[model samples]
Target: MNRTTRLQQITVTLLSAGLLTLSGWGAAASPVQAAAASVAAPACGTGDHGLLQDLQKAHSGADSIPLSFSDVEFLNTNIGRAAGNGFLIGTSDGGCHFQKIYEGQWSFQQIDFPDNVHGWALAAVKDGQAKYLLRTADGGSTWTRLSNQAVTFERVEFLDSSQGFGYNRASTYYTKDGGESWSLIKTPANTRGAAFTSRSNGWAVVIVPGSGYRVMKTTDGGAAWKQVLKSSTSDPIYGQISANDSQVYALLYGDSGMSQTSYSLYGSSNSGGSWTRVIAQETAGGGPAPGSGAAVAKKGPASGTPGNMVLIGKTTAFLAGYQPAAEEVGVGLTKNNGRTWSNQKAVPGFEGVISFTDHNRGWLAARDLNSSTLYVTKDAGATWTARFSFETAGR
Candidate 1:
């Protein structure tokens, strides 16, 4: 374990017990910095640590970050997960340019695409009733509006090459041909997330009016649905969804009070038939073994896919590998029923939002405050590889 984690444990121990050995918040840590243990270089492709060091020195303590389709998919897993081998790792050789800022349209928040080369980006207008969903192909060089009219879109989820799900005003929209076409489904409110074990068997978690959150299961690929679990307690947040072919985890967060909230994570073992509550506070390490009881250890093939990710709270962590203690910030880890997170590392440049494809496979798609380029580490946090140097970077 690194010194940061050790100090964090001491900190949490004191705080949770309602006792303080110190008198200031100077010891507080962000999860982004604490989760990562190292700062190694990126693997594969064409980037290096020396390059990153050169850029870091050039900027005098700034950060740079990047993202392709896969990176975006991982960060947006609340609505989706990896379909196969790697994230949609397709991009033009040069670079993709974000659309120009519209006066009150096209902000690039909601995104959906049927095929690899074409997609849509939705943004709520700054002071208008109409929102924009910018469509792109040829590697994001430019975008165009899909419609002149604006509707109540809150979140967007693409199911496949020709189908997807989107939400507005707590109602679900089903598309047989991407966002080009859409149909309304009977959702009670905005859906927290949607996932599928097989192409035909999928599940969703939605906010029910006056009753917190609930789960929806569909055996025929969401053609129809059934309610499995509904919380009598708190509602689900918008960004806590994860699943593989066999299992899924739907995470929800809402505090009843300042001091009475648990980590509040839930898992679905038998597809979506039942749901089990996991943690209420931040937990770390990998996720659980498939079909294994809490009393037994499971050895399924997918467990190695970084089982559960790790989490970083305001303070306290328990891992190691790279970087310095002071550069620490936020954290990103699994929140399942286990304690051995794999890619438990601090995402360079970005803070607070982190997601992994599996234990060893993770990525950060957020931008840095100092630069516009992207940083990546294939070996967790041991090192970093800088892409696009000699340009604007970020924090």
Candidate 2:
């Protein structure tokens, strides 16, 4: 009676009849948290995107930031890690790497917090002529450029250190003290995602002169901005805007069936007055590999489950959309919310590329088409355990 006990007895009788237990499989192993790797509760039971902390919202219901597993941490990336709901905040670089995820190993502590690791930004040079602005608080590693005074930056936001905001092509700039100096409040404004959850109010999901997708608010941080949800419909493109006022989460996408290409998502309990879709339209099998328009992983495994999308932290709401880069496919979790799941398995020799923290814990690295078996799971996603070894032929 194996195959994980006949898929847990057909998923406890189809989750007692409420239906949809393992749909097309979210991950697999089954029971006893799949028997080890540290899962106290989710074995398809569940996992990664970090922060699951034994998850308990059982079907997306009431999760507006109560996450504080010691304020959560994990960061040991040397190859860019963040495509969905990716904003670890607090900056990194000059010494500021705290990405802690246990069980499979991925703990980058590197601390020296001294705020504003040389803040800078002034954009617009993708050929629109000239104009640049990009300063990293350590996360982007290294980048500096203080001026060009908003030529075509599209968008840049900061609400700490001194204060910040930048939007080129349409125009808007305001620095309070940290960016050295800057001023200007308007020009064209066609932004798609901006955040400053604090320092006044801050929020942006722009494109307001007749385009669509608008929800611009500012208490003082950006100095002034107030359009609050105004999208008549210009094809949908509301990138992201994490929240704090009770709860808010927004990451939108559009233009996906051809080269004009564009997609990146999430939509929270929503904010202001309208807009409520909540992660959908994830068409995997490959999307970001033709000129680098950037957008893939919308339900990998050949477009199933409506092309799934998963994001677990930075204002956890379980929003999802596109995530199939096909290293054979990976993403599984079940801390009891979706009832049962396990065995969408792959880690025999390893080729999954997973990562996690705050719920049982998880991590897996090595992405060179194969030959990277590093594993660890603490049961929130139920089970796994492999430990050491590395090489994409080297490293």
| Candidate number of the best TM-score | 1
Q: Give the alpha carbon lDDT tens digit for every residue of 116-135 in model 2.
A: 23233333332243555555
Q: Over the stretch 260-368, how does candidate 1's per-residue lDDT look in tens digits?
A: 2222445554555565554333212322211112421222111111112223221212122121222222233333433422233344342222333333333334334
TM for candidate 2 is 0.24
- What TM-score, over all chains together, does every model reach? 0.52, 0.24
- Residue 332, candidate 2: how far off, in angstroms? 12
Query: Residue 300 of model 2: what lDDT?
Result: 22
- For residue 151, give model 2's deviation from the true position in Å: 27
Candidate 2: list runs displaced more than 4 Å: 1-173, 176-187, 190-237, 241-251, 254-297, 300-395
- Global lDDT of model 1: 0.38
Task: State the weakest 10-residue window (summed lDDT) of model 1.
Answer: 1-10
Stretches of candidate 1 off by over 4 Å are 1-106, 110-115, 123-130, 188-201, 206-212, 220-224, 230-240, 256-263, 273-278, 282-343, 347-359, 367-373, 380-395
